[model samples]
Target: MADLDAFLRDLAAESADLEALVADLPPQDWTRPTPAEGWTIAHQIGHLTWTDEVATLAAADARTGGTTFADLLTEAAPRVTTFVDEAAAEAAGAPAPELLRRWRHGRTELADTLRAVPGDAKVPWFGPPMRPGSMATARLMETWAHGQDVADALGVHRVPTDRLRSIAHIGVRTRDFAYTVRGLPVPGEEFRVELRAPSGELWTWGPADASEQVTGPVLDFCLLVTQRRHPDDLTLRATGESAAQWLNIAQAFAGPPGAGRKPGRAG
Candidate 1:
């Protein structure tokens, strides 16, 4: 329970930080292009808003034995490869104030709905089902990742916070998913991940005796896993061939493999 509270609080803080970045932007700035190809600042927020609303529906459906989310996906599948992009583009058409309002409202609703989920009950998602706490952590990761795109568009350098620990955790946990999604063999050996956190603490994962290792700054690891920064632009060091290749294709988000940033596109 305490952990869930902490995750929820961190999720809220992450959202608030991103909101602060764009809340006061001039209307014209909302249309500014972000690093995401063909997506503007408005599209970024819109994507977050749409995902949050869908998450809220999934949580509500789980809590009530409804199949709204499953049905929607089934109906859209085999023909709607671009449903996510379509949803974001549709939401981006709203005026800035309206878009902001919808985003704020949708996130609040999602947080509240997640809190109301019964203990240990899983919520359906685009990927695997997750407990409320895990759901909140994924939300935080996405918020931070998309916030990076927005920050790049605005040329703002966000101060890295310990909240990044959640993203790093996801990055490490999703190692096998990163491989399996690409039709590649999942490595049998565990990879040791040692990242120096912003507060100068060492965040370690996997067994200390693991043969394969990845060592780097936590921010760089997070950016690499999120596909926000190209591998060449990060300072992460991989000690094994598989581990080295993983860096090139790592993605924390669920979907098909992401078209990660090009080399030298650090933002």
Candidate 2:
């Protein structure tokens, strides 16, 4: 496993990168449709902020042993929905500068909260309870995925980094999420992933002798798992039937099953 501190730092960095991208968009741009059906850039950012707030509450609940983490999330869902909807509506008529300002505030709050939590602290998540470190990684996955949607709406490309580790962690750990969403049994065999990082180093996870292989640049792997880009959009290659199939439906974030948007749709 990667160092917990390093993982949290990466998550914060990615969140900062995303904030910079949306900092100066035009007012209308915030309302422009994203690849996510019926969601705008504001909606996406709002979703991130909403979830982070829920995470903070869950973390607090875990610390107190007030209730099971699962129960906390169940209670948080309705609140999350209301927050996103209200935030989206509030941002709908705001000017670009105000919208960006609000977004920056929310992002900073989330990032700061994550940093303040102890590494070993467990929190309620969509899946099983996760340590603060893993939860931070999961937040990174969400930011990158939604950041891609925002970039696509503006006809921009984001050159992601070696953050494939976070995406891969979500990919493998959320295997049951994929299976449950598709109404299939989770496969027993692990899949090996070899991706070239932005720093020109190779990052490998899972056993080398695993039955399935997913090899490509780290950016593509991240994009694929996030459902930001189609598998064919990059040079990702899968060697086994299970690997190939997983690639087609990979999703790192929690929610409903993502059938994956078409390639051109993101552009």
Candidate 3:
């Protein structure tokens, strides 16, 4: 079971680590394009800020049982891509220091809001309302995913750590989502997944002897699912056709299918 407090603590730690990386970036680096094509570091932070605010609203709706929240999400659904493009453009225009400040404050408030929700409550989201624990884990996953883009853009190497267990956990949990997003029936057979964490502890999900399985370093698995690293670049090995097919289109985040990192693309 997921613990709200533990997830929140991981969120804070990840946020701080990314902030450290962003804080010292040279001015030129701020405007440098990250791996996310056309998006500079400014746009990355800006996007995170915009998303943090949007997520806060979702949590607030969940808290108060606001009647119109779903309607608003529905209306916003069709234009989600447009909204992101617009937000990125607008964010790019802001000064880097201001952008960082907004993101810092927004994420803190989001953590506080989630802490108040009952552990069992399903919070409103773009896909479905999620329990507070799942919601916190989702936030942590997003932070790590976006942070990868920033790190890649600046040519910084992030040291892998056990913190990735949060992301790996989300990735493993979202195995079914990867198929559903593409209108495919989720395979009924659960694949045994074994991951070697940064701390060198073995992490296993599902049964020990499932016919299908995925085995690899936890960092690589997280990168694969977050769409940050192409399958070819990682050491992940998948047994069985279903597991192989999943690695090709695995998306840890919600919404539609993502345009994952291209094969042989430099990051």
- TM-scores, all candidates, are 0.98, 0.84, 0.94
Looking at candidate 1, the ten consecutive residues that score lowest on lDDT are 75-84
lDDT string, candidate 3, 1-267, tens digits: 347888888888988999999998877888988888788888888888888877777777777777555776677778877877678779778888888888989998888877777656678877667887788888888888889998888787999878899889889889999999999999999989999989889999999989999999999999999999899999999999999999998988987898888788645
Question: Mind giving the per-residue lDDT tens digits that candidate 1 earns over 1-267?
Answer: 688889989989999999999999999999999999989999999999999999999989878879999997997796567888889999999998999999999988998898888886899998999998899999999999999999999999999999999999999999999999999999998999999999999999999988889999999999999999999998999998988989988889999999999898744
lDDT of 2 by residue, 114-204 (tens): 5565655677666677786777788778878888888888788777677767777677667667877888877789888888888988888
- Point to the candidate with the largest lDDT: 1
The order of the candidates by TM-score, greatest first, is: 1, 3, 2
Q: Give the worst 10-residue stretch by lDDT in candidate 2.
A: 81-90
Backbone clash pairs for candidate 2 read none
For residue 159, give model 3's deviation from the true position in Å.
Answer: 0.7
Scored by TM-score, the top model is 1
